[model samples]
Target chain A: LAKTTQPISMDSYEGQEVNITCSHNNIATNDYITWYQQFPSQGPRFIIQGYKTKVTNEVASLFIPADRKSSTLSLPRVSLSDTAVYYCLVGNSMDTGRRALTFGSGTRLQVQP
Target chain B: EAGVAQSPRYKIIEKRQSVAFWCNPISGHATLYWYQQILGQGPKLLIQFQNNGVVDDSQLPKDRFSAERLKGVDSTLKIQPAKLEDSAVYLCASSPRTSGGTYEQYFGPGTRLTVT
Candidate 1:
């Protein structure tokens, strides 16, 4: 399992861009980085995923550098509803059955009104 | 287009008692997973099933925990003689896992177990 580290908490206001970074210095060559968001009393939801470079979607953007040692999840113009615990996962998606999807401690994003 | 479904929403049991949780994955989804989320922590994978076959269950404590998927559609996780530490939210998720691995997982509402 590739160990990952992220901030324990972050704070932002509505309309602000929130960027949470995760570090996985020992990430394997086949490992891909994925992010999930969880609200209180609710299960997590997929946010974004990327192997290398940048991948953007309507909700968030994932930026992975060439070294692949770290990645960032960027939420654009966030709203109060975006306040949740954002978890970072590093695993081998291609080798689906070989390894399990492991999650980091996660970053708690608090969006103020 | 229904997502994964979990039942009983919440359960409370005493130590040494037994409890079971059920999950129904989305139609056509081939990969199902069970996870335990402790308070203030990330979800930990307990088991993963590819259709009706078990793929990974290294984290599961076989002494008290067991899970199974029937007909590659629905799954059940049970704990015998539950322990206090077993109090956590049990989550069920599923994904299509297309040829190359879409890696998109849909999660259910989860069953919160309170073991006293």
Candidate 2:
């Protein structure tokens, strides 16, 4: 498992675009970067995932550089409801027949009006 | 599709007492995971099971924590002689095994345990 580093907290205003970057300098070739969003009293939910380059979905977009050392999650048109803690995790597929995700202290995003 | 289900949304117990939590994963999912999330911290994987067989439990405190999944479906987690440090939310998640090895996990509303 590759250890990840991210900001502890970030502040944003409504209707703005927010980008949260995660650094995993020791990332492995087989590892993929995945992000999750967690609100108060709820379990984390999958937001987006990417191996390299850019991947976009209906909700968010994930951009991974060629080096794969760092990735960014871009949220468009942020709203107050977008406030939550975001987690960045790096792990390979279930090659060992099991999956164990190591989660670091996530970056808490506060979207204000 | 029904999502993961957990019981006893909240529990409060004193130190040295015993407690138990239950989880029902999404239908037809083959992998289940148990995680512990303390206040102000990200969730930590405690155990993982594949169709009733233990795949990894390296992080679980076997001396006081035990989990079982019977018939490869429903599961239960038990803690004996709990301590204050054990106060945390117990999360149950399930994922379908895919050939690509990229299975998205679905988590249930966790069981909040407060060891007072």
Candidate 3:
């Protein structure tokens, strides 16, 4: 498991693009970066995942630098409902037998109108 | 498709009492997971089950916490003589079996426990 560091909190206005960065200095070759979002009383929902380069989906985009030491999650045209806690996790997804994820204190994004 | 289902959305118990939480994973999912999320913190994996067999439970406090996934579908997590620090949300998530073991997890609305 690779430890990740992210900003504790971030504030943004509605309709603006928001980006959150996570640093995993000791990331391993087999590890993949995954992001999840959680609202006040609900469970975390999967947002995006990537091994390297950039991966985009209907919801968000994940950008992994060439070094793989860090990744950023970019949200476009953010709305007030997008406010939530975002978690960045790095782990070996190939470990099917035991894929217990380790989560840290996530970055809390506050989308204000 | 129906997502993971959990029972007794909330529970309240005394410090020395026993409590249990139930979870029904999505149909056909071969993997089930139990996680504990304290306030203002991220979720911590407590146990993982691969079709009725325990795969990992290193973080679970064996003396008090125990879990089982019978029939490889529904599961139960129990705490005997719970402690105050046990107050947190118990989350149940399941993933479909896929190649490379990289399937996205589907989570249920967790059960919130309050130990007084």
Candidate 4:
């Protein structure tokens, strides 16, 4: 499993865009980057996933650079309700069956008003 | 479709006592997972089941922690003589079969365990 690195915490005001970056220097060729959001007292929720380049969905956008060593999760127009811990996971889909995911401490985003 | 369901929502037990947690995965989901989440930390996978068979349980402390999915639908995790460090939330998640490709996971409201 590739170890992921992310900031411990981040703060942003409501309606502001928040970007969280994760670095997996040893990312494998088949590894895909997935981001999950977990609120207090709740299970982690899937927000977005991407292998490379840029992928956008209703919740957020995943930007993976050409090197694929790092990826960023961009949450637009955030709100107080969006305050949660964000996790960046790097692993291959096929490997998930044999190996469990290694979730980092995660980046705690405090969306303040 | 209904999401994964877990029972007891909360459990309080004294060290050296036994406790059990139950989970009902989403209907028709072939994959079930048990995770342990300590405060201020990310979840750690304790076990994984494919249908009624165990696929992986490398991280589970088998001496004290044991889990089973009898009918491949509902599962139970048991702890014998629980310890103080065992206090944490136990989460259950399910994912559709990935026979062809990748499938996203859906998590349930975890059961919080407090061992005093």
Kindly give the stretch of ten consecutive residues in candidate 3 chain B with the minimal lDDT sum: B96-105
- Candidate 3 vs 4: which has more DockQ: 3
Better of 1 and 2 by lDDT: 2
Q: What's the TM-score of each model vs. the native?
A: 0.96, 0.97, 0.97, 0.96
RMSD (Cα, Å) for all candidates, in order, is: 1.3, 1.3, 1.3, 1.3
- Candidate 3's residue-wise lDDT over A1-113, tens digit each? 57899999999999999999999999878788999999988999999988899999999999999999999999999999999999998886466333438888999999999
Given candidate 1, what's the lDDT at residue B21? Answer: 98
**Top-scoring candidate (DockQ):** 3
TM-score of chain A of each: 0.94, 0.95, 0.94, 0.96
Displacement of the residue B30 alpha carbon in candidate 3, Å: 0.8
Candidate 2 per-residue lDDT over residues B13-91, each given as its tens digit = 9999999999999999998999999999999988889999998898999999999999999999999989999999999
For B1-116, candidate 3 gives per-residue lDDT tens digits of 99999988999999999999999999999999999999999999999889999988988999999999998999999999899999999999998887653567889999999999
- Expressed as tens digits, the lDDT of each residue in B1-95 for candidate 4 is 78889998999999999999999999999989999999999999999898999888989999999999998889999999899999999999998
**True lDDT of residue B77, candidate 3:** 99
Per-residue accuracy of model 1 over B29-104 as CA lDDT, tens digit each: 9999999999999998899999999988989999999999999999999999899999999999998865443387
Error of 1 at B85 (Å): 0.6
TM-score of chain B of 3: 0.98
Report the Cα lDDT for residue B62, model 2.
Answer: 96
Candidate 3: which pairs clash?
none
Give the distance in Å from residue A16's predicted Cα in candidate 3 to where it truly belongs: 0.7
